[model samples]
Target: MVTKKLYYQDQYIRNFTARLQKSGRDEQDRFYLVLDETAFYPTGGGQPHDTGTLNGMKVHDVEEIEGEIRHYIDVPAEVHKEYTGELDWDRRFDHMQQHMGQHILSAAFEEEYGYRTVSFHLGTETCSIDLEIEYLSDEEMSLVEKTANKVVMENRPVETRWVSEEELSNFPLRKEVSVSTDIRLVNIADFDYNGCGGTHPDSTGQVSSIKMLHWEKQKKKKIRVYFVCGIRVQKQLQKKHKVIQDLTDTLSAPQEELNETATRVLLLNKELEKKNNDLKMELIEYEADSYIEKANVQADRKIVREIFTNRPMPELQQLAKRITAKTDRILVLLINEKDDKLQLVCSRSEDAEINMNDLVNHVLPVINGKGGGNNSIAQGGGERTISAEQLMDELVDHVKKISGT
Candidate 1:
């Protein structure tokens, strides 16, 4: 078995005694260095590796390939001439805080609710633990967070020790041992004891704080919990405080009144939308009346027609539909100014010889544009060219020819 330096001693952060075991090139041409023992934690047990310097070279990644701990480093041959290594204490301490926090939380869940943590993952942003229970309600989660933080403030000492296979068999462990032998168990005093290989704080108090972010049901028998610990808890509180202040300022209300103010604003927006729809329908009725009165020939034969308006495109399309419903032999071409562009709408009578689809194919290219539609109606919008009147007249002439009117 490969010797793990951290497994035996967790406090020895920097040393010059570690010997270079092997040096070779990987598949990517990058050099991989192995050491007899290392302070660098390998990527395992859902926790990332520790990064530092090995033999004066920057160690970028450390991984456990098979049973060997391989360190990927960037360095010249001269740097490897002497034996030296350094551990990144800041990162290592953060992992310690998170890992110990997990122990406290896992134990609290089991002690209070009889929930067992079946799986745990330590990520860069947040850590997660999957419970054997199907679900944890919001009330239970709030209680768990409160209890976990209380334990952190209590600053209980965290202890670790190696027990023989026989000793481990007698002790009351929270979970069954998965490893073969020489089990190193971390005990959060009076709270939790589990088989874990990840680095952790010397005491539960070093965690500072623990916050349960949320939980979700993963399967019929599993629930996943997301949480942060130590400095992460402070960051979350700072961010939420700023958001609440911003909302209070924007709504011109007290922080306690922000929710009521937001609800009122949403109700007002809904009322405005209903009023706008009523106005659009009234505008369509007025436009349709004028177009029907001005139609020169109203018969069973197809009649191509055009209308120019300053109204919006949606209103114009509604007007065209209203006009088509009044005449059995009418084809309508309509245009309107909207924003900075011109909108077009074409509607064909059921008995009309011309189809809007054929007319759109003929005219869209004239305006250096593209459009498509079905047999009854087609609509498109494009950049304005000259006046609305001139563009409308040109389109009407094309429609007349296509309809054979």
Candidate 2:
């Protein structure tokens, strides 16, 4: 048996009496109760389903399957001869306001700039419509918002009428209808006429207000215009005002000086960062000089092996480069055991005969790591199973074998 949809007759019907038809379980083991007539709207047309109570059971979801409107409850309900369904009016009215506002805003865009609405979405906090146009300038957006607000202020009646497919030509429709049979067209006076199944307010003024927040290019020639209506516009304004006030207080400046104060603060931060980096580089250079003095001299070739605690990887590279630059007879091997992980860096002078890449390749597997580099320099990191001192000793042994020492 097909469930009669009562919402089409009255969108403001908060309570309805219906007859219980059947109760059953689906393949997913979910219980559902069917009614002979229902005012709860099922999920369709970019709008969500109505959530309320049915026969004292919490109705989490309402769906129309095949020909029956199933009220999926949180728990199994006993079959009753008569059932009472209550609608969540706040949710229902909010949807009506946003949905009706969408029709007006979309119509305003079309009337002002010939932009066609291709799709729409009623989100939790906002609503958006996709337009066929590639871009919408700020001025064009302002004009459309102004036009929509003017319609809302005029308090025009919103009428719904059932018409046949042949009768559709009698009205100026903004878009084509999807269903031929049971065609319900929502008309906004002479402004907009389109086939829609969603619920809406009785008048344009009930939408309260419509505010276009912003717009962005979605894909190829489509632009998504984000907006809010009714109570949401006031919410957005309150949030923005609080943010501005906080910024004014924190910066010790008035609202008018916020832009200039922010720019000056950012510029000063950049300068401080540059000076800090210069000082760090000078410190690393001096540390490199001390490392060269503490090297182990072998066969007239200087070898520098050191372990650091929580030193940055870049500083290790810079120290290696500085040491190698000072002398062509030196090989630098550096490791940092910071953060309970092992990291290695190997560098050699330009005239050094040893291939640092080959040395790194041999040491990496011992700690389950991977790395590769040119003949003069290489870097790698791995697990901390072995101490940094152990890796350094292994690297020295490899160098000795290469030098036949």
Cα lDDT tens digits, model 1, 297-365, are: 633454435645576666667777888887777778777666567767888677776778777666665
For each candidate, what is the lDDT?
A: 0.78, 0.91
**46-143 per-residue lDDT for model 2 (tens digits):** 78889899878888888889878999986776777788999988888888998999999999999999999999899889999999988789999999
Q: What TM-score, to 2 decimals, does candidate 1 have?
A: 0.75
User: Cα lDDT of model 2 overall?
Assistant: 0.91
lDDT computed for candidate 1: 0.78
C-alpha root-mean-square deviation, each candidate = 4.9, 2.8
Best by lDDT: 2
TM-score, one value per model = 0.75, 0.88
Error of 1 at 122 (Å): 2.7
